[model samples]
Target: MSQAADRLALGRIGESVRREDATPKVTGEFAYGSDLSAPGMLWGRTLRSPHAHARIVAVDVAAAVALPGVHAVLLHGDVPGAKAYGLEFPDQPVLAGDRVRYYGEPVAIVAADGPERARRAVAAIRVEYELLEPVVDPARATEQPPLHPDRPTMRHGYREDPRPNVIRHLVIRHGDPDVVGDVSVTGVYELAGQDQAFLGPESGLAVPDGEGGVDVYVATQWLHVDRAQVAPCLGLEPEQVRIHLAGVGGAFGGREDLSMQIHAAMLALYTGRPVRMVYDREESFVGHVHRHPARLEYEHRATREGKLVCVRARIVLDGGAYASSSTAVIANSTAFAVGPYRVDNALLDGTVVYTNNPPSGAMRGFGAPQVCFAAEAQMDRLAAALGIDPVELRLLNALAPGDRLPTGQLLTGSLPTAEVIRRAAALPVPAPEPLPRDPLRLPGGAGNTTHGDGIRRGVGFAVGFKNICFSEGFDDSCAARVVLRADGRAEIHCAAADVGQGSASVILQVARTELGTDDVVLAPATTASVGSAGSTSASRMTWMAAGAVRDACREALAERERTGGADVDVEHVFRHPQTLPLDPETGQVTGARAHVALAVAAMRVVVEVDVDLGLARVVWVGVAQDVGKAINPRSVEGQIEGGIAQGLGHALMEELVVRDGRILNASFTDYLIPTALDMPPVTIDLVEEPEPDAPYGVKGVGEPPTVVSTAAVTSALRDATGLLLARVPVRPEDVALGSR
Candidate 1:
């Protein structure tokens, strides 16, 4: 193909293709996971431990088994094969056998004819527990008893000490670690645990095939991985367990980990009947993992002219109970610890430790957002110390193409860091309305807590970047099958889970663009139909899935041409360029690359603070992202807006409060997320700087908006209040109490 064709925009790639599931989703006709039901399906309920740390002394299921409506009562002994499962390591037990390490660890399960009956049976199942002191602090994890022993048998080749609770401790030393600059600023930032708070609760339906196998319909991020993990626990082969994707409400990384997938299948297989499990709002909070709460200490060194010299950071992540993708999270945090800036010398250490807190796993932005907050804060401090404009300072140090990351990976792809920052900073700020207007304009809004008595406005800026695909030698690939039908239409088959990131629409758009036909059909994502399309995560779906679809379509078209316009079917697996694992001692990746590509975002946030009432409201968010390409402009804008809203919630209100490792606010009434009123108006600048290797020059756009929005908002708050705010979900008390 010539360069002219590569530059041409045709079919649906750049057009705003209407979402296939939009109408059904908005009209309430879509059958989400919670809406799935089977005829004669029994309800499944799990009995969770009440104590965060306790010994399971005895379990008597006689009462539950005797219940008239109950079909099955299962305990630890009931697990037929594997007793543990996880994405990275099999550490979390299918059912707690001896001791429960977390407050909501599943101890037993009950299947009954109805939901209420299952709940009653769960209550009736007698279980005796001896309470133990909980290790709830990540800072003190090394002094606590070993959560998962650090022996050779348990270690999965990742570097770690024989400490009590440390899961992975990654150290990176690049350039001159001992380099000192003319000026230095140090700060410590703390981030709270945040929930995905997806609207749909975890739900699933499982039915026995009456042939020693089962069919499961569940809302999850990866169907093949679920099948692999569930089949082992059920004592069945992967083929025996067919997994289908139910309609997902939203994932945002919450559904990346297993939830009710196995429980529903276990009950269905044991009872010889269909089983359904739907977690209520309260149960959903404890059922899935939350974002890891992070504590980061950063020191930024720069010359008097505000030129960055060196950066050193120590990041600690609380990996509650089990190691679910903790190693990957730590790697990302360490790699992007210094933000999207050029640092000559750096020293970094990132660690994730086991504790009795609620389990923390994948969340939007992965682990980069936590460190971004700290790094951006340090940048602002440095700018203040150097007496320079924050935006100018960031622009001066912005990473560019050919720049080397702290991981030692050469930026061979597009690195528009300075461009993104410049565009964001140049966005026009919204003008203020007349005073004595609506009380809703105040921070307290209709509550009338403040009538514009002491409101002040400030603007702030931040930039963040992260690896676009799974890093560290993960075998990431996507399989696609394209069939050019006799009617000149194309059908695409792939098991890429659409967790509300518009992967389905993106796949169809890619097919239409490649096949040069508007009549493209996207098949439902299922493991029984296609090979693994990998997880819809790491912002790799668009690149991997679309690449596979394009490859398969090209083969199908070529075959059709060879056969004189006959129908042709082709299957292909799109593999990313190999990424190497980081060297343990030096923290540098030695191979060609550690990440496929990097996606950068810059944000300028406007915030209004009411010092008297200690309430703050984000006014506007101006975000500039280098997306390489926009498959659909509307969807890209929606993703950016949604991400900014979520990020704003993280900055101001969303916090999963825990006391002694127990979640205090599990329901929405207690936990706060950004409502429509809380979200600021987002203005997005889509910068098309295509990666030469990506399909259609597409880079990930989902996680970057979220990565820096929080920092920008926090920086604004600091500007308005003149206080060094070091913690997230900045409460009104923090603002009001520390008011100057």
Candidate 2:
């Protein structure tokens, strides 16, 4: 085939090739980590502290060790090497040491021949706890005793304050500090902690490699990071710990932190046999970190004509017992506190405080969703005061390519904020469904509690933007190797985790597109073979993986041309354009290179409120997103749909109920998620303006949809009820009763 013909053949980049795992996933034939098994494998179970805050008087594992089927029982004292491991900070104890700071803290592990035996051994272990007052309130967490008295300085030296509970305090002061507008709206908003609630519970299989090494098969976001953190704890070198990606059912940032990785390895090594650990539904809730429940006090000042003048915000996130990624979360919250609107003057202070609540870390939308709720609500309020349409109000102040952020970083990527908002707002609204609305269509759905009395409809609009990759000077890079096979197929190998995000497919697409070949093979993701692709979080997998694959394929193609069709292999570590660290005190970025790229999304939500019942039903959601480029339009749309679903869940029903630092509802029966019946129809408008700096001009597509959808849904609820709904997971009580 001629080069010109090959170029015209649409190899794969834009085509929505069927996801390789879709059939097996749908048919229940795909093997996840939980499905893994091995001969003579021991089952591991953890003994958790019942008390939220307590001094560990004693941990007697004697009885557990003596159990009939128990192969080994371990305590903090039994750890052969490092006793603590964390995502960003090595502050959390692998096994509770002298005290337990939060409920469900792992205290002991039991390895036995069977799960039942493991459970029995775990029950046999005795622990005596002296209950202590739990520091449940994030507002006062800093005033309480330090969760980590010897907490070390953060990796980048961002926190040198020596404060006990405050992980990081980032302040953004841009333009005039004290600028009050003629019209202003001030409100305090609260967001409940949300669970990633991924379908596959945290599970993994760890096998002793017989030579003082461990091989782990697990579902995780970043295998290399897991190995880096797990290796030292296991008293082994980094190369001694190998991780292979087990099929992940779903990981919306839930699998970023270490769960059973080290524990499974320790058990396997101790028992001299392979070991498997799986968290049940209830344990899964406590085993992993949650979305930081936030309290945001926001004051938006605008000109009488609905132009944004300034935004002042204080965002406090409940770090919850450990600093998984709280520092980064706080930075994101502070950076995007003002949402997508352009404001000349802004003052923002964001803090993540350590509390004895469930550990809070990464979730879909990261920290942006919480602030987006507050900022967008403020936009609506400001519009009401100015007597202007909300959409028009956002358009008047929508950020463009040259607008500066509160953090002093200038927007240089494909923002297209105004275009997104305009396109979403222009989409035709669907007519309300006919009356005698299926009892299934009512707020209570099949419950039939509502007779459609006092039903009112409302519409709300919101727009939000988030930095694409790791920011604030984190060295982020991905490595990929492309092999041009003699069989006329291109093979791509990268440690980038698929994580059910179609990243593997995206890699294949990029390889086929760059090499102009219809066939491409994806090597399994493993840390033992390839270099680090960094964490799959931050919606950076597609961008990083595709860029690396494209670059490596380009190099391999050149070699193949030189060798005249002989097999060629090339590896490339694709680095994103450099980003500088922010000024710690001022939270300001000086250079134009603070973020790899940026993506914006606009959403319009339609909701109906049953005023008497206080139940709300989302009618439809229309969204326009600046994806930069659609490498695979189907996958991009799927991402938007999935993100919107999670966002809708957060806006209406998803909350991890915590009381006095203990999760009250950990079971799925109690913790509600959206069902298919609850999902509203979504209409999406694709804004494919290419990002000049991104791979194939593609930007991160997974997170922006979620960033704005939550705000839009809740805004609609506020509009329908005519009430200032200042919190999320908006309860029926907030909108029900004698109509607001």
Candidate 3:
């Protein structure tokens, strides 16, 4: 091919093209939301409740208002319009007025000339509270008095339980509820709350437009959703609130909810000056929702021949305080209760209840990670009881096309469960390194704690799947506008937040491929520029953005052809196949499907444990993921690697210690995450099975790795320890002591 032709194909589909922001990010030239500022900007700070649950007797902001640099001291009553806001349910208070439901709930806001002054003003505000007993346990949340009694009872068109503090209770009775297997294995598992821990804290700059409107430059997942939720609270029309996506350092699902967006906008509008709000490290921990800590009791049954029979599970998720996306989280937990397997019968009860714990909502895998850990552990137990290999057992019952989920949603998309399992299993395992070689490579790296004493190596495998797009009748769609310049370059406009998952690169690649040009530019993501590209979550950005960009490019090309090679601009909205809501009573799909697509992943984790010290180190991870298609092979690999790192944290050391609804370890010094030294070498096999219904046969790839990697790591830990470790963030003491 000529050099010209090669240049045109530089970033087409299937190529490992460089990320658009890679250079800027690596060179330290990238500006995140925290870097946002404007002329005459005042720093905004929030005053949070110290108690978990408390009735506000009175809020005195006189001292705060009299503070030297304080410009505004506002309470809930000062809210221009709505007093409450949330992602799915408007139950969380914009500012706690009558009461505070959870610890760190915002009760008042302060704006000052500087960040220090704002902090001082916040400290000066006095709040008199009447302490109340917090509903700290999800299992007994319903028995407690109502936390949100006046909130609506309906969610996603399903009536919630009338019981107090019950967010959503989903029951799935598939096949025979009374079916019995020749052999059964039961176990109880617990998952601790995990934080998104994105590098950039929640921050935003709200500049009031002179015309009774505001422009919010913030780090958020969805610009349109932010506008939708912020406008009502500001007593402004939707058009009056414009949201622009600032550079996001990372948002595994943390930016999906309101943090400082509304508060900053309110301060900006009230003061008529740019208001900048940024959560410090400590405040960031309390400002956002975490992964729902769960308790799962699972029983897996199988025949003596190693074929699966039935699965029975009771899953309870602690959706702390308010309903952010707890209803949908519970739905996912129930739908995927039985991993990526075909079971003849299943009886699953999944409930997410209100608690005084930190609010739990979208985190990487949503609710699938918690359930996958439990289900995979039960699968291992069943395998042990049936005297079968874990990989063989998984392969025997791996979900295939045409198989129906527990929710009765047929697998019409690409779900290469068995293939991924086989591929992951076939990957060559790393040979054990010679002992007394490098202390840095051991379980307690560089600690010089041991000289390879009591070291044991173990290997384990896990396979899991997750739904691709938003499910349960959400109008999942993306819009893109393509303008073909007379110079033959193309500009693609879509409001899809990148969130550090390389969606911008994917969009650029798709536009270049469709328009047959390498010179393509991406417009800044903003609500004012284009229609909603939905949220940069649920692993849906690539699929949705690609479809929208592809359609828009094609339309623009056709217009150009019609105009005899003149410049053309076209806009198009691409909608996924419609999904139906699940039946509230039976937990069955109301129509052909309840999810847009499904992706599967299989992982084999190898670990070395110091049995005496209770320390563990992951040596290797082999993953086979059902990507449907790889838009950028390198970017896909990065996603897989990043997900494995997060999963490793969950399996080994990422524990958000919450004691009675208070986060004990909110800082990085106490809450550990996987660093470069802790990460293992990852081997990946991308399974490209085309989903017939998807554009370019692509499925979302961000979530499946996280869904299964935690399970795989824990399986390895159990293999080495010979212990029934039922909980995650496996403490060193549990391994060192249990072994004795």
Give the CA lDDT, 0 to 100, for residue 613 in model 1: 82
- How does residue 664 of candidate 2 score in lDDT? 93
Per-residue lDDT of model 3, residues 457-524, tens digit only: 99989988888999999998999999898889888889999898888888888988898877887878
Superposing all C-alpha atoms, what RMSD in Å does each candidate have to the true structure?
3.9, 3.6, 3.2
Deviating ranges (above 4 Å) for candidate 2: 1-11, 153-155, 563-565, 737-740
Query: What overall lDDT goes with each candidate model?
Result: 0.89, 0.87, 0.90
Instruction: Tell me how candidate 3 scores on lDDT.
Output: 0.90
* Model 2 lDDT per residue over 1-740, tens place: 00010111233888876776787888998888998888898999999988789999987778888879899888898887898888988889999999998989999998999999999999988898898888899888878888777764354658356667888888889999698888989999999999999999999999998999999999999999999999989889999999988879799999999999999999999888999999999999999999999999999888888888888999999998888999889989998899887888999999898888999999988899999989999889988998999989999998898888777777787888888988999988899887876888877888898878778999988999888989878899999988888879776779988888788778877887788777777777888768999999898888889889988988998898899999998889998889987888777886766677778999999998888788889989999999888988888999999999999999999988899888999998999988889888899899999988888888888999889888999999888888888888998887775364
> What is the descending lDDT order?
3, 1, 2
Which run of 10 residues does model 2 get worst, by summed lDDT?
Answer: 1-10
Question: How do the predictions measure up, each by TM-score?
Answer: 0.97, 0.97, 0.98
Prediction 1 TM-score vs. true: 0.97
Residue 406 lDDT in model 1?
Answer: 91
Model 3 scores a TM of 0.98
For each candidate, how many residue pairs have backbone atoms clashing (under 3 Å)? Answer: 0, 1, 0
Q: Write the per-residue lDDT of candidate 1 for residues 629-718, one digit (tens) a residue.
A: 999888888889988988899999999999999999999999988888888788899999999889989998889988998899999999
**Alpha carbon lDDT at 231, candidate 1:** 96
